[model samples]
Target: MRLRVQGLYVMDASKRSAHGNAYFTGFGKAKRIVFFDTLLEKHTLDEIESILAHELGHFKFGHVRQMILQAAIIAFIGFAALYWAFGSETFAGWFGLPHDPGVVLIALLFAKEPVSHLLHPLLAARSRKNEFEADDFARRIVGKEPMISALTRLTRDNLATLTPDPLYAKFYFSHPPVPMRVAQLRGAVEA
Candidate 1:
């Protein structure tokens, strides 16, 4: 069987941010992996390979499409809610705001900001689940040890807090904390 691999791009972002990150970019078969050059500098080769395997897991599991679908659904719901609110006299009277496009735009921005903050726990949880799945993929390909090492190094290099407030993490973090991730991999290895 022939194996097909997509493009890998290394980005220069050392000047922009202290943290290094990676992403899967492009669409369809053209799907590519983009990594910060700093990631390569800071992690070992095995760690990098493990990280790539984790990204491959995302592709194999079709998470990109699922996330895009989820975003589309959220957008539809947001638009529908705005439409309903714009038509309701009570919304205007309670807020004492006029019905204007500019007003609508401002209201939409501010209203959704709060709603997004309110919904953060759920959304972040979903993202963290996906990260776990991807990590599992890495474990299968590169073994648990390599993945755990990679994750630990990545967290350290990125300066992620080992222990963060549960509420703050639950609301904002897309990936599970480093200790939790390392422990999960360690558990799998022991199993």
Candidate 2:
């Protein structure tokens, strides 16, 4: 499994905030991993390696490409919907909107808000599943204890929500809460 990681660098994020994070970005040969300076300050080398492994899991699973494709499909659907709305006078007339392109476009923006909200759970669920897969991949590479320790430290240092409401998490959280992730890692170790 060749990652073809192009660059590894740290950013001076502490100048603005103390939040700690690491991320993998780009596609194919352009891939890069970046760590917030604050993360280096807060975590041990082992923890950092665990986090790096987790980021690499995203690359291993092709999550970046999957996300890009999902975005493209959504954008295409949105444009198609807009085109249909523009041509359909009944759609505009239903809301007493003028059968004009500009007016219909404005109405579409308002109309899409509810649909976006409805779609939030599905999108967030996929994102959270990807996060779990990444966590598990890191566990496989670096051991669950290190990954769990890194996650625990990240949650504490970042002042993350400890226990979000289930419904809220389902709808909004792109990653499982720290405690949830830690529990899953611990369970995986036993199994």
- Each model's lDDT comes to 0.80, 0.90
Q: Can you give the TM-score per candidate against the true fold?
A: 0.86, 0.95
Task: Report how far residue 156 has shifted in candidate 1, in Å.
Answer: 1.6
Per-residue lDDT of candidate 2, residues 123-162 (tens digit): 9989999999999999899999889899989999999878
Index of the highest-TM-score prediction: 2
Best by lDDT: 2
Which residue pairs clash in candidate 2? none
- Over 4 Å off, model 1: 1-6, 87-90, 96-104, 188-191
Supply the global lDDT for candidate 2. Answer: 0.90
Model 1, span 1-191: residue lDDT tens: 12244878998989787577777655567778888988888888898899988888888877888888999999899889888777775655566888765676677787888888888889889888888888888888999888888888877888878999878887899998877777777774321
